[model samples]
Target: MKVIGINGSARKGWNTQSLVMKALDGAASMGAETELINLYSEPLKGCLECFACKRKGNKTGGICAIRDNMRPILEKAHEADAVIVGSPNFFGYPSAMTRAFIERFLYPLSSYMMKDGQHVRLLGDRVIPAGMIFTMNADPKSYEMMNYQATLGATTANLQYVLGYAEQYNSYMTLQFKDYSAMNANMFDGDQRVYRHETQFPIDERKCFEMGRRLVAKAKELNQ
Candidate 1:
């Protein structure tokens, strides 16, 4: 079984990447081969709306018509038994690269036709378990106040609709910088942020690890 993790954060070895790597480690522990793809490593674009995939008898099959840096990455995702996408929540949503990746990855696989009250998926009956991870500086209360669940849930809903099964994991109050004092952002208490990172980040890591393990287990059950 193969599971892939896509890190949409530009900063490698940071909170988003750390959690994704932990998840990949968990999948590896469950006897699945795993790979990590960093979206920031290459330039990519969102869907171009060419509709080539929607064209009758299209030669591209279910893949997007765009032949760019994301073509191979999309192919890997299509073949993956499970996929985990991680990003640092920017403003009220995921990073720009994460959103672009989602568009390029899902738009081709989604169809306009509906049957039995559900849109037909290009993958047909294939169930590829998927997961999303978000790291944010906002606390839980701010997250709720912003109605993040509604907006973020919609993204996961689309993933579930296209990919069969999708889940989300969130890490709040994430450390944004190694030396907070070095930056000019004075809205937060640097000491408290550091303390939170030292105390709570490990717990988040463990939670993501379980998320990866559970996703792999679900993929096994579905593919069995």
Candidate 2:
């Protein structure tokens, strides 16, 4: 079994990447080969609407034809038994890199053809369990007030529709800075942020670990 993790945060080894790594560690514990790809490590662009993947009788084989840095990442994502994508929320949505990655990743696998009144996916009947991780500065209440679920939920919904199964996990009130004293952002209580980071982030990590293990198990069962 193979699982792939995508970290869409520009800051490496931060909250988003750390959670993704924890999830990958959980997958590895299940004896699954796992890999983590940092989206910021390479330059990638969003889907250009080239219609290459939409062409009838095209030889693209369900892969994007853009021929960019994301192509190989998309190929690996498709081949994996499970995939976990982690990104920090920006303006109530995932970061630009995450959006770009998914635009290329999911669009190619999507099809206009309908079956049983449902849109067909190039993935066929294969079940590839996937997870989305979002880290944000808003607390649970603020998140609810912002209605972030509607924005982020769309990605999870599309992943499920295209890849068979998908789940989302959000880490609320994430610590955005290592040294808050240096930054001019005084709206937040630095001590409270550190306290929450020390206490709540571990719980989030554990939950993400379980999510990883559970997704791998689900993939094994469904794919079998």
Candidate 3:
């Protein structure tokens, strides 16, 4: 079994990468081949709306026609038993890189067809186990107030619809900086902003690990 983790964060060694790595480690523990792809390091372009993949009788075989760094990654995702997508929340949604990666990943596999006189997903018969990790600055209670939960829910629904099974892990109230002095710390309550990164971050990391392991287990079951 093989599981691939994709990190959408531009900053290395940050919260998003940490969680993705931890998840890959967990999958590794399950005797699954694991790999991590950092999107920031790759030359990925957004979907060009070229309709090449959607063309009738196209020969692409459910793969994006765009020839770039993302093409190989999308192919890997298509072949992998499980995929873990990690992205830091930007403006209550996924970062641009993450959004682009997902679009390219899903678009080619999607097809329009009529079923029972209604449009349906042609590739819906294929099922893949997938997981998502989101790191955000808002706390759980404030996620609704910030509208992050609703926006993220829609993303999760789309993934589930396309991938068959999808789950998410959230690390909320993330520390954006190592030192408060590096940025305008006055805007945040210093006392409330003081997060125990050393302690709590590990807990979040363990959750990511479990998510990876769970995906692998589910994929294995499906394969069986």
Q: Candidate 1 residues 1-224, lDDT tens each?
A: 89999999999999999999999988988999999999999888988889998888887757788889999999999899999999898878889899999998888888887889978778877889988999998999999999888877777888898998999999999999888899998998899999999999999999899989998999999877
Index of the highest-lDDT prediction: 2
Pairs that clash in candidate 2? none
Query: Against the true structure, candidate 2 has what lDDT?
Result: 0.91
Q: Which sections of candidate 2 miss by over 4 Å?
A: none
Q: Please give the CA lDDT of all the candidate structures.
A: 0.90, 0.91, 0.85
TM-score of each: 0.97, 0.97, 0.92
lDDT digits (tens) for residues 186-205 of candidate 2:
99888899999999999999
Supply the TM-score for candidate 2.
0.97
Q: Model 3: per-residue lDDT, tens digit, 1-224?
A: 89999999998899999999999999999999999999989667888999998787898877889888888899899899899999999988888899999888888776676779854754445567888899988788888788787887767777887777899989987778777767787665544555546667899999999998899998878666
Candidates ranked, most accurate by TM-score first: 2, 1, 3
RMSD of each: 1.1, 0.9, 1.9
